[model samples]
Target: MSLSIVDNGRELFVVKLIERGEKIDEHVQREIMNHRSLKHPNIVRFNELRNLERGVDILVATPGRLVDMIERARVSLRMIKYLALDEADRMLDMGFEPQIRRFVEQMEMPPPGARQTMLFSATFPTEIQRLASDFMSNYIFLAVGRVGSSTDLIVQKVEFVQDMDKRNYLMDLLHTQCDNGAHGKCALTLVFVETKRGADALERWLSMNGFPATAIHGDKVQMVS
Candidate 1:
């Protein structure tokens, strides 16, 4: 109890419907057991917190939370041989540049020349890249597929359903996915909306429409106490 949540950054903060968090953790552990490699990518998003402490090859975290762990836990980054920003543009959009710069410039981590650094994004506007300048040296920029392309890892479908048809449309998609056996028991679906209010309303609508949904956004933040 001595450590705040950030100080106890020993586990990944996996977002899940409260009912499903434990199940996802169990599934992750089972998959990890099947791999002989102590350091594999699937666990990168989950066990990365533990692995980083033990000097694993790669680590992953959202910028804000990672900043808390580093600053509060007083974790030194002198041994950080690589620094990779998976969604560089998104981080900037989320207003994490100051925190990121602290990690890159002020922390005990090695400078860009001494470390392998990579910034990945679906789009890298020049202005956003400028925000990342303090952390890179002679870096090579790689762009694959179409500009502003959605991730290859998942299929993104866009629809223009009328306001009244939105619920039915979403239900149809869910039913179609279920019928196709697409989302396994642990498959997570994220619904995005323009505002926190919309997120809350949509979450309730989905629940009423027969889907288990949880709403999480800045506006809905609860005091953890």
Candidate 2:
């Protein structure tokens, strides 16, 4: 959606606020990759305050960082044409309402009718609705699938394996998938473990067994490529 807006060839300043937590660095790296893949000169590359000084057509930031930049006179919201909040509920759940309100209400951002505001979330609660009411005007509510029901697109399966045999079992599963022609990017798999050490161990085991894999966790510093 953002890419499409950038492709529209209009000079517009857009701001996207995201949730801040243990995964904030990972999220920022992912966003940076997405922006770089576009190779659009108008798309601002995130280099902390340096790129921001030249002005920004699009700014993706966490509420705290954005507020700090604003307080330091590094950026202004007065000319913001579009404002977006990704994972709106998660940000509120993380107790970011104060910062969000500060930037959206207390800052120099244009009023609701003057600027476009969008909030996206997997689930919307009453608090989110109140937030929308306070920050948006004449907005349309869009819902996909049922409110509390899971989508039919995902298939759920459960299996029980002994702890001692778990590695072998996973190997067998991977072998089966490969035999069925799931390779390259299509063969991507995400395995969640309880601890960072466990993730590292699993990654090493997979690499030793000839299955390429990388482990991502909060302890690792993600590099933008």
Candidate 3:
């Protein structure tokens, strides 16, 4: 990573270039999904003067937010005593590492020994662990439960049927469930098709065959940051 310095009086912005991973790895996506599962505190904000006046001790935010707050602070950096990263591994993904590293470099965070630094994650690969070493001293590494068993932990049934038999198979399952009175009238079964066209076709097929079906596709979430 290389940092290019840009200076002005009121606002200072440093742009750093970090290399992105060559291939899109499944592990990184899984880590991000797991990290994003914490929906309770999706956005955390702190009032600047109120927090400082009350002697606020703890704060949590994304790296970008933290860096912005720190840069816009009126006090010195010595006030920041402790820093912790919730999901260190996922934070190192493309378009994120540069900001994270820039914060560590620009923000006058106390030395590794003077200030406490903690890293927590579900899956910290060897490379991420090595990268995290630059921000820690004698950190105690802890690994709990079984590792590399996320997929195995889930019990899923896999069946391959002929492409032409899919519609009939689904209809038979729906008819059997309705006949048995298992789910009242509708079971709310979620069907996932591979492509958007396939989903549209399946939705039409189900509705034409006297079943109320709907297909949903995801849209990009608009985040302020």
- Best-matching candidate per TM-score: 2
TM-scores of the models, in the order given: 0.48, 0.60, 0.47
Model 2 pairs whose backbones collide: none
TM-score of 3: 0.47
Task: Give a tens-digit lDDT track for model 3, residues 1-225.
Answer: 111111211111112221122111122333334343332211113344554434332333455655666777732355555555655666766456766776765677667787666666677788567756887887788888765456566668887889999889989988877777755676667888898788888999999998899777532233456
Clashing residue pairs found in predicted model 1:
none
Candidate 1 residue-pair clash tally: 0
Models ranked on TM-score: 2, 1, 3
Off by over 4 Å in 1: 1-57, 146-162, 165-225
What TM-score should be assigned to candidate 1? 0.48
Q: In model 3, where is the ten-residue run with the lowest total lDDT?
A: 2-11
- Residue 217 lDDT (model 3): 57
Report the error of model 3 at residue 48, Å: 5.0
Model 2 lDDT per residue over 1-225, tens place: 433343322222223343233244344344545654345443333445676687755666777777888898987888777777878887888888898999899989789988778888778788999999999997899998776578788888999999999999999888877777735322667889889999999999999999988889866776779
lDDT of 1 at 179: 70
